[model samples]
Target: MGKGTPAFGKHNNKLVHVVCRRCGKRSYHQRKKRCASCGFGRTASRRVYAWNKRT
Candidate 1:
């Protein structure tokens, strides 16, 4: 892994598949600490459908 490169399989440390409290949708986001939709600030551990939910 090089600098500035995105790492995989490490969402556990950062908490993967978190559902946005604002939009009530799950996301597979590592960084960018903010919900893609509604710009929420909190997240949870939950897998969501890609097409059905926002990333």
Candidate 2:
């Protein structure tokens, strides 16, 4: 129950897992929006695109 630790049973606020574009390695990041492994910021991360499908 320390600071930054994921909560138990569905209340977890852990750092999100993301892949670094520059280093191609997986890392954990929070609102700071930077890769801990390579020091790459959010701009160097992968882009996410959402598509809307019409029924």
Candidate 3:
């Protein structure tokens, strides 16, 4: 019955996020080449919105 449980645990070594070079946060996607924290590869500016202001 639990077919998904065993399948998901087998591929746990996949490295998806890494330490971002700009913000130094662990949100950089390896395959996408884009930092989820600071928008390193996608855009020149940080990946943020006006409503989601940090302080």
Candidate 4:
């Protein structure tokens, strides 16, 4: 390993997902401030795709 490898490790070690304010899931991106599961903070309407089946 080189000395530069530590820098990469430090940058990649940060949290990628945090708790979402709406969905309350840990699928929210910490840096982007958006939820992956519920699409919170991105849109006002709920997203429904044809690929996703309804329960």
Q: Pick the candidate with the highest lDDT.
A: 3
TM-score of model number 2? 0.42
Candidate 2, which ten residues in sequence have the lowest lDDT sum?
46-55
Best by TM-score: 3
Q: Which regions in candidate 2 have their CA more than 4 angstroms from the true location?
A: 1-15, 28-30, 42-55
Order of candidates by TM-score, top first?
A: 3, 4, 2, 1
Q: Which runs in model 3 stand beyond 4 Å of their true positions?
A: 1-5
- Each candidate's TM vs. the true structure? 0.34, 0.42, 0.74, 0.60
List the candidate numbers ranked by lDDT, top first. Answer: 3, 4, 2, 1
Given candidate 2, what's the lDDT at residue 12?
A: 47
Instruction: Choose 2 or 4, whichever is better by TM-score.
Output: 4
Error of 1 at 35 (Å): 0.4
Residue-level error in angstroms, candidate 3, position 5? 4.4
On residues 1-55, what C-alpha lDDT tens digit does candidate 1 reach at each position?
Answer: 6766486656557566578665777752447777765445543533345786665
Over 4 Å off in model 1, which ranges?
1-17, 42-55
Judge candidate 4 at residue 10 and give its lDDT: 71
Worst 10 residues of 1 by lDDT: 39-48
Model 3: weakest 10-residue lDDT segment is 1-10
TM-score for candidate 3, residues paired by index: 0.74
Per-residue lDDT over 1-55 for candidate 2, one digit per residue giving the tens place of the 0 to 100 score:
6767574666645547577666777763656677766667755554433443344
Of 3 and 4, the candidate ranking higher by lDDT: 3
Clash count of each predicted structure: 1, 0, 0, 0
Better of 1 and 3 by lDDT: 3
lDDT of 3 by residue, 1-55 (tens): 5655656766858889999999899989999999998899999987888878877
